[model samples]
Target: MDEMTWLDYLPVLGQGAWVTVQLTVWSTLFGALLAFAAGLGKLARNAAVRGLSVAYIEIFRGTSLLVQLFWLYFALPLVGQAIGINLRLPPVTAGILALSLNIGAYGAEVVRGAVQAVTRQQYEAARALNFTPRQTLFRIALPQAIPEMMPPFDNLAIQNLKDTALVSLISLADLAMRAEQLRNYTQDSTTIYTLVLLMYFGMALVLTAFMRGLSSMVGRWRPAQR
Candidate 1:
C-alpha cells in the first residue's frame, strides 16, 4: 500500500462526519420525543401508565449503552426468529434507536425533575380559574418548567454526540470507523487517531454552542406566551 497524506484522508473522514451528524440530529429529535412522553407518563395519574414509564426508564438507564446497542443489533434478530417475526434492524436504525433510548431514559429524569420543580401555587392558581389538569400542565406549568430543562438537555445533547462514536463499532461508517479504516490501510495510527479525536472534539464544541443558544432562547420565554 502507498503512503497517503493527512489531506487525502479528509474526504473520507468528512463523509463519515456527515453520517455522524445525521445520526446525531435524527436521534436527538426522536429521543426528545421519547423523553417527553416517558417523562409525562411517569407523572400520569394512571397506575399502568406510570408503571410502564418507570419500567422503560429503569431498564434503559440501568443497562450499558454498549450492551443495549449489541442487543438491538445482534440479539433481537434471534429473538424475533423464535417468535416468527422479523426483528432485524439496519445498522443505522439500530444505532439511532439505541442511542435515543439510552439518552431518553436519562432525559426523562431531567424532564421529571424540571416539571416537578414548578411551584404548587401555579397549579393552585390554575385550579382557581377552573382550568383542567391538562390545560394547567400544558399552559401554566410547561412554559416555566421547560426553561429549567434546557441546561440538562444541553448536557444530554452533547453526551449523545459523543455516544455516536459507539455506533461506528456496529459498522455505521461514522467518523471513528473512517479513522480506523484509514489507520489500518496506512498504518499511521497516531496521526489518524489524533485527527479523529480532534474531529469528535470539534463536533462536541459545536453541539454545545448550539445547545447554549437554544437554552438562551428558552430562558427568554415569558409567562405571557402561556
Candidate 2:
C-alpha cells in the first residue's frame, strides 16, 4: 500500500469512526441519566444515600480512566471466578461502561452545580405556592437549571467523543484501531494518522454544530433565546 491508497481508506475511516461516535453518544446519554440520578441522590437529605453518591462520584473522579478500563477489562475476571458471575465484557461493552461511569462522575458535579445555581427566591416562591419538593424540582428548579447546564453538558458530550478513541486500545476497532491497521498494512504512518486526524476533526465539527443547535433549542425553551 502507498500514499496513493490513503484515499482508499476513507470509507474505512467513516465506518470505523462511526463506531466511536456511537460509543460516545449512547454511553454519554446513559451516563448523563445515571449522573443526574446519582447527583440528585447526593442532594437528598438521607445521609446514607448522599454518602454513597459522594463515594461513587469521588472514586470515579479520583481514578484514571485508563486504570479503570484495565480493571474492568483485566482484573474483574480474576475476582469474577470466585463469584461465578463473569465480569468479563467485550471491548465495546467494557469501553461503554467505563466511559459512562467516568462521564457520570463529572456529570454528577455538573448536575449538582447547575441545580444549586437555581435561585433561592425561586425555591421560596415555589414553596409559597405549596408545590411539593418533587413538583418544584421537576417543574421550577430544573427549568432554571437547564440553561446553565447546557454549555457544560455540551462540552462533556464532546469530551466524551474524543475520549472514546481510547476504546480502540481495548481492541474495539474504533477510529484509532482502524488508523493503526491502515498504518500497519500500508507502512505509511503519516497519511494514515493524517486521515485519522482529519476524521476526528470532522466528527468534532459535526458535534459542535449539533451542540450549538441543541443550545439554541434549550434557550428557546427557557424563553431566553429572544
Candidate 3:
C-alpha cells in the first residue's frame, strides 16, 4: 500500500479537533459555574455542607480521569438501569459530565483560595459600610479576588483543555482519537502522535496568549482608589 500523504488525515483531525474544542470550552465554562458553588460550599458555615464539598473535591481530584471516563461510559449504565433512567450516556455527554465533575473539583479549591485572599481590611470596611455578606462578596470581594485567582484559573483552563484528549479513550472522536485512527491505517504512529502533540500545543498556546492579553488589559485598567 502506498503511504498516504498527511493531507489525507487533515479532515479527520479537523473533525476531531472541533469535538475536542466543544468538549473543553463548554465543560470549562459550565464546570467553573458548578465549581463556584461547590467551592463556596467548601467554606460553608455548616460543617456537614463543607465536609460534603471537600469530599467531592478529593474524590474526583484523587482519581485518574481515564478511569472516570470508563466508569461513566460503562458502569453508569448499570446504575441508570436500576434507577430507571436511560441506561446510556453518549460519548460527548459522558465527556461533558466527566470533564465537568473533574474540573469542578479542582476549581473549588481555586475559588476557595481566591475568596480567602480578600483582606480582612476589605471585609471590615464592607461591614462598616453596612453591606450584607452577599453584597460584600459580590461587590467588594469577588472583583478583588478575581485578579489574584486569574493566574490559577488560567492554568486550570489550559490543563482542562489538554485533558479533553482523555475523552478519546471512551471512543470520543477527539483529536487524539483521530490521530490514533490515522496511525492505525497509515502505520506512521510517530508522525501521527507528533501531530497530535503539536495540535494540542497550538491550542494551548492560543489559550495562553488570550490569558496573557486579558491580564495586560486588566492591569492597565487598575481599579480606582476609594
Candidate 4:
C-alpha cells in the first residue's frame, strides 16, 4: 500500500472526532443531571433516599471506569439473558452510560460539598422568612452553591471528555480507535499518535472555554438571587 499522507488521514480522523464529541456532550449532560439528583438525594431528610444515593455514589466512585465500561458492554447482556431480558446496549449507548455514571458519582460529591458549604446563617435567614425546605434549597442554597460547583464541575467535564477515549476499547470507533486503525495500517506511530494528542488538546481547550463562560454566567446570576 502507498503511504497515506496527512490529507488522507485527517478526514477519517475528523469522522472519529465527531463521534467522540457526541459521546462527550451526551455523557456530560446526563452526568450533570445524575450528579444533582444523587447529590440532593444524599442531603434529603429521608433515610432511604439518602442511603440509595450514597450507595450509587460509592459504587461508581470506588470502581474502575474501564471495568464499568466492560461490564456494561459485555456482562450486562449475559445477566439479562439469565433473566430472559435483553440488557444489551449499543456500543455508543453503553459508552455514554458508563461515562455518565462514573463522572456523575464524582460530581455528586462536588455538588454535596458546595451545597454544604453554604453558611448556616443563610439557612436560618431562609427559615426566618418562612421558606419551605424546597423553596430554601432552590431559592437560596442552590443559587449560592451552584456557582461554587462550577470550577470542580469544569474539571469533571474535561475529565469526562478525556475518558470518552476509553470507549474505543469497546469498538465505538471514537477518535482513539480511528487513530489506532490508521497506525495499524500505516505503522506511522509518531505522526498518528501526535495528531491524536493534539486533537484531544484542542477539544479540551474548547470545552474549558465554554465551561468558564458558563461559570461566569452563574457567578453573575448568583448575586441577582440575593
- RMSD over all Cα atoms, model 2: 1.6
Off by over 4 Å in 2: 1-4, 221-226
Q: Across residues 1-226, which tens digit of lDDT does each residue of candidate 4 receive?
A: 9979877899989999999999999999999999999999999999999999999999999999999999999999999999999999999899999999999999999999999999999999999999999999999999999999999999999999999999999999999999999999999888888999999999999999999899989899555542
* TM-score of candidate 2 to 2 decimals: 0.95
**How well is each residue in 154-179 modelled by candidate 2, as lDDT tens digits?**
88888888889898889998999988
Greater-TM-score candidate between 3 and 4: 4
C-alpha RMSD between model 3 and the true structure: 2.7
Model 1 CA deviation exceeding 4 Å by range = 222-226
State the C-alpha lDDT per candidate. 0.92, 0.87, 0.86, 0.96
Please estimate how well model 3 matches the true structure, expressed as its whole-model Cα lDDT. 0.86
Give the top-scoring candidate (TM-score): 4
Candidate 4: lDDT of 156?
99
Model 3 Cα lDDT, one tens digit per residue, 1-226: 8767777777888899888888888999877887888898997889999989999899999998888888999999999999999869998899999899998899999989989988999999999999999899889987777676667878988989988999889888899889988888889877677777888889999888887776665555566424
Q: Which runs in model 3 stand beyond 4 Å of their true positions?
A: 216-226
**TM-score sort, best first:** 4, 1, 2, 3
| lDDT at position 225, candidate 1 | 36
Model 3, position 21: C-alpha lDDT score: 85
TM-scores, all candidates, are: 0.96, 0.95, 0.92, 0.97
Between candidates 1 and 3, the TM-score winner: 1
